[model samples]
Target: NATAKAELGRATWKLLHTMASRYPVIPTQDERAAMKQWIFLLSRLYPCGECAEHFQQMLKEHPPQTSSRAALSDWSCSVHNIVNARLGKKEFDCRTLSDVYKCGC
Candidate 1:
């Protein structure tokens, strides 16, 4: 279990680089599947459609810094706190964070 968690931490590190942009943005499908899964796993964190759409556009253009495994773990933990602080407790769907939205694009 510890090893799996460590591998997941590594995956999250790879994901942080590939997932979200630094200036705030939505993410690609691969990114969303990983990062959003982290969100859902956290006791806090929810999705917002309007914010998600806006950020997606941002991510489509600008990318973020490459992340380390330790950095991502810290970042993910902070995201949980930040989301909880901003949005309060509520359920969000995994569907909202990815590029799978039917934009007809």
Candidate 2:
């Protein structure tokens, strides 16, 4: 079960980061709103209940930063780092996100 959860988490993070990497450089207002709404829905619908609750709280505190692709990617990295810290894992270098999460799009 733990292995499954970990795999799910990794897949989810990959999806999130890839989406952020491919986000519009200058998204329209409606696009930004949609991105934020999608994030909220993700928090609500994540497979792991405990992880979903934690993500919801993080959203309450940090909210989604959808101003630009970079902002959303950086916000996601920061939030991922927060979870890493909680898990006693090493934090990722946020500056290298573009290099790390190339969506090839």
Candidate 3:
């Protein structure tokens, strides 16, 4: 179960980061609104109950930074580091995000 949960988290973070990487550089207001709603829905619909609750709280504290691809990617890394810290995992360098999550699309 622990393995499955960890794998799920890894996969979810990958998806989120890749999406952030591909997000518009200067998103329209409608795009920004959509991204925000999508993130909120993610917190609400995440498969893991405890993880979802923690994500919801994090959202309240930090909210989504959808102003640009860079902003969203940086915000994603920061929140991911928050979770990593809580799990006693090493923090990822935010500067390496482009290298790490290359969607190529």
Tell me, by lDDT, which candidate is best: 3
Question: Model 1 over residues 1-105: C-alpha lDDT tens digits?
Answer: 567644654454345433332312534556645654554443132134443543344334432222433334344434434444554755334333333222232
RMSD of each: 15.4, 0.7, 0.6
Give all TM-scores, in the order shown: 0.28, 0.97, 0.98
lDDT of 2 by residue, 1-105 (tens): 899999999999999999999999999999999999999999999999999999999999998999999899999999999999999999899988988898775
Question: Which runs in model 1 stand beyond 4 Å of their true positions?
Answer: 1-48, 51-65, 89-105
Model 1, total clashes: 1
Rank candidates by TM-score, best first.
3, 2, 1
Candidate 3 structure quality by residue, lDDT tens digits, 27-79? 99999999999999999999999999999999999999999989999999999
Better of 1 and 3 by lDDT: 3
Error of 1 at 45 (Å): 16
Q: What is the C-alpha lDDT of each candidate?
A: 0.41, 0.95, 0.96
